[model samples]
Target chain A: MKRRRRFHIQPKHLFLILLAICVLLIASTSYNTFMTHSIQGGFSTVLLPFQKGMNRLGGLVYGKIGSIKELYGVMEENQKLQEEIGELRRENTRYQLQLKELATYKELLKITDEYPDYDMVGAHIISKNSGNWFSTFKIDKGSRDGFSVGMNILADGGLAGIITSVEAHTSTVTSIIDDGRSVAAMAASSGAPCMVTGNRLLLQEGKLDVTHIDKDDDIDLSYKIVTSNTSSEYLPGLLIGYISDIDKDTNNLTKTGKLVPAVNFSRLDTVMVITTLKRTEG
Target chain B: MRKPVFYACVIAAAFLLQNNLFAAIPLIQTTPNILLVVTFVTAFIAGPKDGMLVGFFSGLLLDAFFGGSVGFYAMIYMAIGYVNGFCGNYFYRDFVTAPVLLSVLSDLAFGILVYFFGFLLRGRLAFMDYFISIIIPEVVYTALITCVVYKPLLKLEERALESSKRSAKRFV
Candidate 1:
């Protein structure tokens, strides 16, 4: 009975055993927190020998590989011959395209000789942040060369946008169709100029609007709208887009119409940014 | 203990293989979820709570690979495990057809619940699209995988559980 009673601890001794456990936990945690760097160093020392052996083995294998590659001249010659054949075929196609393009440019130069007042820069649309598409895009031109902000970036056919941001190796162009941008445009047929808001909402639907022109104005389908010299910015007669829709308002003072953008947003590969800002003498 | 360690190693290895190796076997991705089937086998064999615990962690591991929000998978998987356990109380005799259908249902339930929760978070329900595109296809694939993975895993779990019970009886 006494042995049984001794084994079965009283409530007081139970409390003492629990107290000892608490002390052990506290000491271990404090020691670990303070001595972490030293404990890590001990593990690093255990791993050192294997790491050294791996490094030595890697160097030995790489040296052997260089010598073996040097002995394989015949295989290298065959690969070079295959690469040359592929390049020649590409060159032939490019030459034919250049000849065809030169003839067309000769005709365009004859027709547009009156517009010597305009300076043109051609560029490519390289990459889009289409995940955030409406805001910005990157082009492969920069300030260290001739590119600068406010330079009008043009495609072969029409005005894309002015350069908004420039870096040493890249530039970002905010398109004329974006919400925050507007252009001073005029109907080519009517010779009437008005403020045209950017067609961002329409662009999302694959359309653009030339706003602020009157319903009585002669803005019709397929006629060009160009950036004008009259209102603050952009040169005169730079093509913006073609008039696609004429919304006739019998009641309102001014008319708004949809313009079909000449620049295809898709299939954009290359463009040039005209590095010109007209300096005011004031 | 060794088996659990081995299973952990297999989990690590499957992940590495999925990300790294070029597939010699092209059929796996289109047909089934190997890991999900393994979790299901473990659940039914372990019976409710332990199965829930294992399923919850395995689902979490899968979700971690996908970079998903943490607790979403945990809640769904725990529910799957708990339900699997409750169903374990039913007739275990007709396993051939039963296991396949039950696995399909469970996978469908898990996918639907996750989709429903996603809709609630987004504040609009896309019920038709979610059921048609995500849940049904996932269930079909999960069912195909469970058919192959369950038999072997069930046998292993049976042996382990029997041994554990014997050990418990000895202590008693």
Candidate 2:
């Protein structure tokens, strides 16, 4: 008698096949194939409406909870704000007089605008990455809204991040606080060049790592850090942060310090994207 | 067919909540891995095959949404599901300790795998910092949330299984 032979699909075979598919997917994505982009775009487009709805709902709930929690402190804060308003009013008059003097100086020097006007669009953050591994988040604006990768995002009047990926109706922003992100920056007062590097550990203390400043440069806590004109990716003169501390490197050729960022990243809701891309010279 | 559809919906809802609602809530520095809880619980209740399928789709959703690369998350989640499936034989509806303990272990494994691929391979040699700052907090949070989320998921799975069996009997 001849024995009958049968084929069976074991769990091991299934696992191996799935693992192989995952490897292929990782490879294709790294190469940035058009197929992967389209697939990602399609998924984003389909999920956009749901994400928007959920974001709004979450915001509402968060707002309610915050208001209730702050009920006891509201009166105290109000009094403090009123006192601050009185002080600001006096300072505003002084600033106005200084502004008039500056205008006269600018006219005397015939200095037209130093920086060109940037076209900007407002966007709402829809969702953030679930894991804490990276600080990437999605915005409501997308490619259709004239958004593209590398557009600088500003929040609280300071550079927050740059657009990394754009889909049909949403785009992802990799903030300056994310690991491996670096910005070419300089001391606004002395023009001493430095580098602002993102380190999540450092960010826990609400500061970024500012490194590579010339040892001889006269940079101090009073100098604000701004994006350097030499930077190829970021727009020149955008406020990044203020230098909180500085120290000479062990090599003695450069200095490093901590930067207290102007933007409060933990509470970002709305941001302005400078639609202008830094034009690279041919 | 119905079972798959039901599980898919559950996973999708969990993904949405993880990215939007829980993320927005300032409960802690990091949100619980609700999706991981969902995958592990399903795998613990249902068998290896269903667990793998659920894990694959959940990870794919994450990849398509915000992951820098595709398949990285999918692979991690799939392996997690497959490994957790072995616990099905030991799972009991009333037993809470097993699920919570499994959740902590699985989250730890997940954090380590993510660190290995996302950070360690990138030449980021600070293992102690990454482990303490990110991996530990996430594991503790995930374990805490698993206790709250496990019961509802188990109830849902049991109902779905009963309905599917009833429908199959009717068809037969």
Candidate 3:
């Protein structure tokens, strides 16, 4: 008699089945949609305190190390700063004398008299995304701190990123150098427009790709790139990077170049969120 | 220590160290994945069930804190734990080779899976650059850490199991 053996599921088999189910579930959903309001949100909410405490501890340790290192550079930096301040004082007096001339020049140029007032909020980076690339990081400040998705983030005197998501106590910043991030940029000197986009290849070399420049535009080394006046989301005149290695595209109608990003993403620890969103100008 | 609570504390502590302390270290960057080491060691020492549980929770914690996708890392880590757990029976308290080899294999799998699903699917095709620049460094770093942390983790596993067994005996 061929009696059917009793069916039994071993723990390993059960684990494999569960793993398959999870993989299939993730595969079926659109990645972007599945990320929002999913179990991750709850986990973030729960782990906030621990992350915050750990970050504070790490910050304290890093601060001490930084202070020791800065001791060696302090005298040199002080001398340099004093010299610069003296030069700036002379320049300020000279600029004061030329204020009337500058006003007339502004009028002739038809430039706006008032600049946008940028409200700022400071935040500490609590953790980075689970990858080798420093593309995304979570800050301790969140919606409660008046931070929200799409607010521009700045670090190290450069436009860093835009807030991608916000929870109550933390938010995520997707940096300008991240794989999918793109910024509308222009040469600060000539106001010639271009697009700066993140490229992994360029990121390895600590640079970004600047594309769509008209072939005739005389972009050159050391030219500053800033957010374009045409960018709807980012505020105009925020420094993005410096242009380098301008080369014509294969089509020859346009040019592309590499930009050394102003923000050193690897050293990011703190950032300022420009609270005010940019209004699209006509 | 109670097994479940021990696992929870260790995983939480590992998460904190990975996100905060190790991440803040300049030379380390994100190369040494401390949590991955914990997952690999736990799976290697305790077998499949423990491995899956550790992987799921740690991966979920990682995803929850900094992940874009909720289940992406959780799924990857869980698979890694399960696969590594197969070698659990062959583990010896004094032997480090199995754990080290398993760590390399697991870390390599993680690097490939992440590259395949995250970058390749998204049209990033610079395989040689990525393999050399990111994948190799991370795998080597993770494996090196495994060598350092393996003995301690095995000891921890032994104590936790012994305590659990004692509790079970008392219940009887």
Question: What is candidate 1's CAPRI-style docking category based on DockQ?
Answer: incorrect
lDDT for A112 in candidate 1 is 66
Best by TM-score: 2
| Candidate 1: regions farther than 4 A off | A1-110, A113-124, A132-135, A279-281, B1-172
lDDT of 1 at B136: 69
Better of 2 and 3 by TM-score: 2
Model 3 has fnat of 0.46
**Candidates ranked, most accurate by TM-score first:** 2, 3, 1
If the candidates were sorted by their DockQ against the true structure, best first, what order would they fall in?
A: 2, 3, 1
Say which prediction, candidate 2 or candidate 3, comes out ahead on DockQ. 2
Poorest 10 consecutive residues by lDDT, candidate 1 chain B = B19-28
**For model 2, how does the per-residue alpha-carbon lDDT over A220-241 read when each residue is reduced to its tens digit?**
8857899999998899988899
For model 3, how does the per-residue alpha-carbon lDDT over A1-282 read when each residue is reduced to its tens digit? Answer: 332334656767778776775675465444555445455556677888887787778778888888888998997799888879977987897888799898889786544322347788888888876477547888888877888778999887689999878887788888899875789899988999999999766887899999889999867788999999899789888889898788888998999999999898888888989999887655
Per-model lDDT: 0.57, 0.86, 0.80
Worst 10 residues of 2 chain A by lDDT: A1-10
Residue lDDT tens for model 1, A1-282: 123223554433433443343344335534553232233223223423433343344345545665687669757878887889888898989989998999999998768633455555555443342211133455655565677767776675677777765555455677777643689889887877656665333554556767778767777778788887674556567777888777766677777777877777643446656566644346
Question: Could you tell me the lDDT of residue A29 within candidate 1?
Answer: 35
lDDT of 3 at A230: 92
TM-score (C-alpha) between model 3 and the true structure: 0.82
Better of 1 and 2 by DockQ: 2
lDDT of 2 by residue, B123-172 (tens): 88989998898888899889988888888889889889788877767655
